[model samples]
Target: MKTLYLVRHAKSSWKFDVIDHERPLNERGLEDGPKMAAHIAAIMPKPDLLMSSDALRAKTTAVFFAKAFTIPDTEIKLNHKMYDFEGRDLVEVIKSVGDEVDTLMVFGHNNAMTNFVNSYGDLRVDNVATAAFTAITFEIHSWQDLIPGKTIYHKAPKEL
Candidate 1:
């Protein structure tokens, strides 16, 4: 079985004058991001591969999970495509994952995260809050052949 954990970037600060891609996490995100990452790590197995969008907010959120999993910086991949708000780019990235990876953690934006979970996971999630962690287990052998899978786990900041 392959397990995919999807995490939406922690809440970002609109207070910045920078572009959307450069927006940093707000105070709440800093506090909740690590907590949620550590909480999830305590329950589930560590990811074989950890990836994140190049966007500052997403990358920062991924760092929390990487630390919790004890994943080295060299092993973490930063992808530009994941910066997509739409789910298509994210889908392509996931489908392209090598078979060697049985577990994967992805940090990205929403509408994409929410849409992916709703479409690919059995559970119907109305929204994926900032720093929310959602896991889906697939019975398929390859990431290329994705089907609707069961939502094995889900946790948000407020739920913590």
Candidate 2:
């Protein structure tokens, strides 16, 4: 069995003069990131792989969860492909995960995160809000199969 946790990057500061990929998190995002991360860490097992988009906002969000999991900086993976918003790159990245990883955590943007959860998990979520987390447990042993799995949890910062 495999468990996947998909986390959307927190709210970003649009006030920045930089490009979209360089936008940093806002105050609320910074607050929510650690809260949500600690919440998940308390309830779930540590992830075998912690991956995030290389974009500034997404990577910052992942750092919070990584710290909660006590994952070293060297163990965290930053992938530029995960910066995709369409979910296609998300699918490609997820499918390419090694079989040795039984549990995986990924931080990225939406509608990719939202689309992925709706299509690959049993639950139908209208929107996966910022700093949201959704976990799906699949019966398949291979990541390449890409079938619908049981949606175990969907958490939002507001609900915490």
Candidate 3:
């Protein structure tokens, strides 16, 4: 079984009126990042690999989660494709992940994240709020085998 933890990046700050990609996490995001990380650490198995969007907010979110989980030597890979990627792009990225890591975590933005969940999850969730988490379990041997309706857990941090 392969487990995928889809984590939307924490809330971003609008302090700077700049490009959306340049925005950083807000105070809520800072607090929520660690809180959400602890929640994930309590139940989910340690992820062998973590892939995060290159965007500032997304990378920061990944760093916080990785530190909270104490995943030593686990680096946050910067994937530009994750930024504003559609469902197909996200799927392709997952499929390209090295087989050495069975359990994985992906930190990215919404629209695509929401699309991915709706396309792949078995349960019905309205929206994956900022810093929210959704865990999906699949019976497939590889990431490519993961398809719609394979999710086992669709939970948000608020629900925890």
Candidate 4:
């Protein structure tokens, strides 16, 4: 079985005069990131691979989970493709995951994250909020065959 963790990046700060990719997390996001990360850590198994978008907000959100999982910073893989707003790139990235890794965690933006989860998982979610986490377990042995799977959990900061 293959487990996939889909995490939406924390709320971003518009306070800074920066590009969308460079905007950092807001105050509420900072608080929520760790909270949500710890919440997920309690239930999900340690992932074989941790990946995140290279964008500032996404990367910051990923750091919270990395800390909670005791995963080293160097071990976290930052991928430019994960910066996708459309689910296509996200799907491509997921499908490309090495077969050796049974579990994977991915931090990215929405509606990409939300679309991916809803499209591939059994559960239908209205939205994947900031610092939101959704886990899906696939019965297939290969990442390439990403059929619809069970939605194990979907947790957000507000829900916690």
Runs off by more than 4 Å, candidate 2: none
- Distance from true location, Cα of 115 in model 3, Å: 0.9
Score candidate 3 by lDDT. Answer: 0.82
67: Cα error in model 1, Å: 0.4
lDDT accuracy of residue 141 in candidate 2: 93
For each candidate, what TM-score against the reference?
0.98, 0.98, 0.91, 0.98
Q: List the residue pairs that clash in candidate 4.
A: none
- lDDT per residue, candidate 3, 1-160, as tens digits? 7888999999999989989888999998998888898888888888988898889999999998898788752477889988865666778888888766788899998888888888778766677788888878777787777765467665565666
Cα lDDT tens digits for candidate 1, 1-160: 8899999999999997999999999999999999998999899999999989999999999999999988875687999999989899999999999999999999999999999999999988899999999999999999999888999998899998
Model 2, 14-49: lDDT tens per residue? 997999999999999999999999999999999999
> Among all windows of ten consecutive residues in candidate 3, which has the lowest summed lDDT?
148-157
lDDT of 2: 0.94
True-vs-predicted CA distance for residue 117, candidate 2, Å: 0.6
Provide the overall lDDT of each model, using Cα atoms, as 2-decimal numbers.
0.94, 0.94, 0.82, 0.93
* TM-score winner, 3 or 4: 4
Model 4 residue 47 CA deviation (Å) reads 0.5
* Model 4 C-alpha lDDT per residue in residues 65-129, reported as the tens digit of each score: 99999999788899999999989999999999999999999999998988998899998999889
